[model samples]
Target chain A: MMRITRDSLLSGNANRRSWMALVNPSASELTQAAATLDIPESFLRKRLEGEASRPLIKQERLISLQFQVPMPKKGGTGQFMLVPLSLYFVPGYFVTLSEQEIPFLSQLIDPQKPRKRWELVLRIIAEVTRNYLPTARSVAREMAVVERDLRQAQRHDVVYRGLDINDRLLTLDLGLLQLEYVVSEIGHFLPAEDAVLAEIHEDTRIELSQVRDQVDSDQATINELLESYAYVVHNNVNHLFKFMAALIILATIPLFIPGAVAMNVPLGNFPHWHYGFTVVTGGLVLVEMLTAWVFYRKGWLRLD
Target chain B: MGCQFYDTVEDVWVATERYTADGLFLLMPEQVHQCPQLEAALQRCLEQRLYCQDAEITLRLPVALLAQDAQFGTVGRMTHLTLHHTPRSLAILGEEPLIRRLQQNWLGELRHTSMGELLQRVLLSIIYSHERVARVLVERLQVLRMALKTAMGNTELRQIVALNRDLGELVIALRETGLILRNALRATPGESPVYPLLDAALREQRRIEDGVNLIHERYLAVTNAYNGIVQNNAHTVMKVMTVWLALLMMPIAFIMPWHMMTPLPLEHWHYLWFGLLAYVFGVTLLFARWARKHGFFSM
Candidate 1:
């Protein structure tokens, strides 16, 4: 599933030159893009495969930038997955290659709008930085859900949910940190001559820093919630064990008297004397009542 | 064809199907074909409307368009809307008052702002509308949680289920809208005035999303608690029934023995019936005590 789309710089017909966006490119498509854009096939391949040794901005014959963007995966557990996107700045046009369809890229480079090559590049970086906000926001929401669930009940399912959210928050935090560093590096790579690029870099830096702050705050919140949930679950289990022990102690007290009476153990006066059944039964009744009253007053007989 | 005009003093544009005594009339959707620019703007507006039904600003260079719909009144609501912005000229389409409000609230206040800034304000307003609804839902969730703590009937459970459904829908809608807005903000220039506002709005939207998700979690918890309460109630009923059965059967242990003719020892006694009565009473009392001690009557 690969798509190559050509977007024009402006809407008018006179100066409608096209830039290429390759979505989920195949090997042959990558080679074609490399040949047409005069970029090295290896550079294109490495970026698509996300095999870059480090985030870099190189200007040999053609300018190239390798950065990562967080892509969402479809699942209930809410995970943060990052994918690398490589950009090649060819003469009179720009090319973007990614293993997956980056929807925000298409939005940034609208065919109907007129944008310079540098403007498009800057927009792409800005958009990629903003993309983290939504995913981070989602993770925060999932954390809140887990926190609420823990408040309602300390069940294993809820505990697992808290752990799951914690994992997500950690993944998001790592991604955001890496992105912040990449963005900073990109800012330094921009030429000092272009004031527009400099301004864009500053704005992007600010936005990225804000995003990092938000991620850190959310991570802190999720960590706190998970710790509290663990403590609550442990306390609940201890209480349950104590309640069961009390129940066992109270239940065993009556079994002894009943067993002795049924076995016909002749202690004082049994069936050999008149009213023997009455005297024996009455004595057992008094003992049972007194034991129960004592246990009740001591709070061991409480069911709730 | 109706008369169309712009209020130069108020900087408001009016478009209507019929000539009005006070306002002006602009070109309808069908009449703007001659000017290719206006036609293109209308086409873009229509495309945006396909996804977002409310007010939106779609900026295409050489022209920027604003479309809004106002749903007023209670039953059979009447909607009046207008679309316009300042670029080459004030090209206003649709109703007048909607355009005026857009001018005074968004465009006029943000005159020095970039298109991205104006668009961000619009998007934030839309997102905040959902936030308000989410706040109400969170409050309702708290009420439901309180109710479930004591007793949860079928009605309350049904309400929780309904609320869950609503929250699911709300979350989906908000997420989709948020994604769209984020993409839009990204496409704009980084130096756009909306950048800071975008950060704040995104933060607010995140908070709302968190609130909704929390409510949903609480709803599930309350439901599970309700089921536990029901099961506990059933167990209590069974426990009481078992105690009663034990009490009723206690006398049968002694009564069955007396039916035998071999019981001749106590038969000659004068107070044999009284002794049997006392024995039965003592055994019943003992059985009750044992039952009580075992938590049969604890609840």
Candidate 2:
């Protein structure tokens, strides 16, 4: 859908200007917008088709920029979808083209809050970068939940969740890197003497830098959490193995004693006295206790 | 100058400066004042040594230098070695054994390696040594995990915590040293031959970090599992005790009332003793069956 609104209409024609926003635009809509804005239809077509074969920013009579914004995806996996946003800027007109509805663009749709074309673009960029912070925070929270689950029980489900969070955080990092590059490139195209453009450039630079730093910090945290999760799982397996080993030791003692008696060995006066049965029974019990005590003392059994 | 020269090819420290080939100079902490040129070089790279001031192996150059503490083995104390590397010469100030070992191990490479490559080697050697320590920690952790399988006690827990702490400290040291080297490399102007070596050192640093992190994760998981096992064992013990208590109470409750009676109802009866015995045996059998059925003996 294509929504074109004039800022002058809502502001009593004080400063007449128009901006176009395209949400999931078709080829025909892109062509129309391209014709109205005096831009090459191919530029809009390439962007609308989601072709990102060029650098983030391209300069000519009209300036075109392509950058990605973080979008949350639905599923058990806490993954973020990177949606590419294409912007075309001329003297007094600005246009934004996206494959899906840009959630933050609604703020600019209200014609009552009129903004200059560059100012609007800067705000859009800032909003796109800010979008990552919330996603990062949510991912961090999800990681913490997974960590808690891991502590309670080393289950595969928690591990899968942890891996999913790692994947999402990696995606966020990649997207932020591309965004930083784009923002830095935009600074080169701004007029050197324009104070407002310079100020906007500086603000965008600082904002993007902050976002990148935050993403890096989040990535480091996720990495550590994932490591801990793996460790918890390993420790649990080791515990099970240890338990089984102790069980084997316990089972071996009884088996060895009976096997020895069945071999017809004359040890302990076996088969030589009327009270042999009683003696053997008592001896078996005694030996079992001794073995258990020994194992316990050697740290092989968890009797306590 | 009255000095001893250790030859890489010969693998021996001779008490003569006759075979003075351009290579690393090993300097002791005390000998730093003896050689004015070496002393100046140490002052130049003094700031760089701050990060690794307490590290066993540190890279500061007029030539590659290592300061070995004579009291402890090379691995025992952080060898406070000052190593310097210059294009014309390599000077080291450390213990005789350490220098001799280095000479023997890198005999062929030391003879042929350029000064920059030698510097890189020194840095790489430091990183590799730390990496070895990390690997040992990892192996120890594996052993600890195996020990944990059979039982976990306070000692086992302490060992795990200790290993984790050591690995953590190693990771931090490697990172700081790596950063220092990288920054130092960047600060150097023009094209220096040490970039590749520094770059390799950086890579090794990262590898050590990764290895340490893996060990830490495994330790954490194993520790948690060990605690769970302990708890489960405790629970089982409690259940068994409860079952035993219940069983013991039944016989006591049956026998205590007989003793307090003024006259037993069938005391003169011929089968009275047999009946009481049968009754006690039947109740014991029933209670044992019930306890088993309720999962008291499941462990």
Candidate 3:
């Protein structure tokens, strides 16, 4: 893929260089492309290696930055990863090289209306920053879903719904933090002279700010969901415990009455009847049912 | 090489780990023959009969693996066999290759499933809790998008459209995250197959989708109630305006001077203007207060 870089630009000439359509280049192609543009080989190579490329030294005439972008894959959880590339721009021409095709840039720099070098670069960054909005929105959406699950988890007999919501919120929180970091980098690139790029940069900054706000809003909602779930579970457990305690108290009430009758000193002279135990047992059963009915009507024992 | 095995008798999931192994060992339980998906795969394998007559049963592996086999040449050696006794874990492992292949083949499918599941859960949660009305409103935006197509029109429709685009973009991000998760899942091994967990995950996703639909219904119901209230308010406003206009005409009638010719007082005109203005002002203040309390002005 790097094979097409310098030669492709040279053969087409500077005026006719149709660099718009060149995306999805291989690692070697990116290396070759970087070579053609007089870019440092390591700069381009580092970008493609992984999503978490640490901030490092500036290669001459080029500044490489790596940031995470959320990707949703099937049978997989969402993740933020670095997209590698080296960018080398002079007054006349500019070049970008990446192992995998970045669709956002490709859309912006179409053949019919090719963007200027600086604008292209800034727009690429701007678009990437804009991505935070959608990412935040997605997180918010997922969080909402998680929240819903937590609420209804009990209905489905799944007490683990809270865990799911917690997990989803955690993931979103991490993504939002990474998004903030990426947006802050755009601020570093804002220059006084390039007012246009500066404006674009500012717009992106606001977008990042909005994303943060959304994330904060989402965090609050998650917290509330957790609290509400906790309260419900706690209240339910408390009610059940109270009912159990009530049952014990009610059962002991009749036992106390029998003890009182049997231990009475004045009644010790009377002879025991054959049906006494049966009568006492029946009376206890009836009293227990009556007590249960009264408690149930008073809303002490909830079926749920 | 380090090899370890643990049995989870309580959960019916077995876990085994082996280092320095090049191939996977599949020990299908007798119960596997009962599963339709497994049965089909088994039947295909038996029909192909790739192995010589040494064994009575043969299992058909995926064609991509067959191509791989063709490239590498026949089953040469038993590199690894880390036995696991848990059915749940085994089932999950069985589905691993399928999940991986699906993830690779259709990123959109993966993204949609994950996103769709999430949206569903959010909606379900809001359905039970009256306190989360605002979130329910916000979440409805996604359901509306799924209901409507790409080019939904009008103000409400446009908002929904914008929301849908937002969801699509969000799904893309989630898809990226999903890829990372896939990698993590691949890296992590367990006593049980990951497939049962995945199955449950998918089920949970479906449950969430169901919840979203319910939320959508609830949202529409709430919107309908608002629309009805607006309509009733419009009717009330028309009635009030008509009454005011008729009352104003009474001043015109009074000015005709049928009874006013006897003693036309300047105080009457001042009182009339002041009263009319005060009444209008009072009505305006009341309207403003009502709108403010209901959050109409904020919108």
Once model 3 is optimally superposed onto the true structure by TM-score, how far is the C-alpha of residue A126 displaced, in angstroms?
3.6
Model 2, position B167: C-alpha lDDT score: 63
List interface RMSDs for the candidates, in order: 11.1, 15.5, 34.4
- For B230-262, candidate 3 gives per-residue lDDT tens digits of 233343344344334433433332222212112
TM-score of each: 0.46, 0.48, 0.40
- Summed backbone clashes in each candidate are 2, 32, 41
Of 1 and 2, which scores higher on lDDT? 2
Model 3, runs deviating above 4 Å:
A1-34, A51-59, A75-101, A143-195, A223-228, A248-278, B1-299
Stretches of candidate 1 off by over 4 Å are: A1-17, A74-80, A151-156, A193-196, A257-265, A270-304, B1-299
Higher-ranked by TM-score: 2 or 3: 2
The C-alpha local distance difference test score for the whole of candidate 1 amounts to 0.54
Candidate 2 yields a Cα-based lDDT of 0.59
TM-score of 1: 0.46
Candidate 1: lDDT of B193? Answer: 49
The DockQ scores of all candidates, in the order shown, are 0.01, 0.02, 0.01
Instruction: Give residue A8's lDDT in candidate 3 (0 to 100).
Output: 21
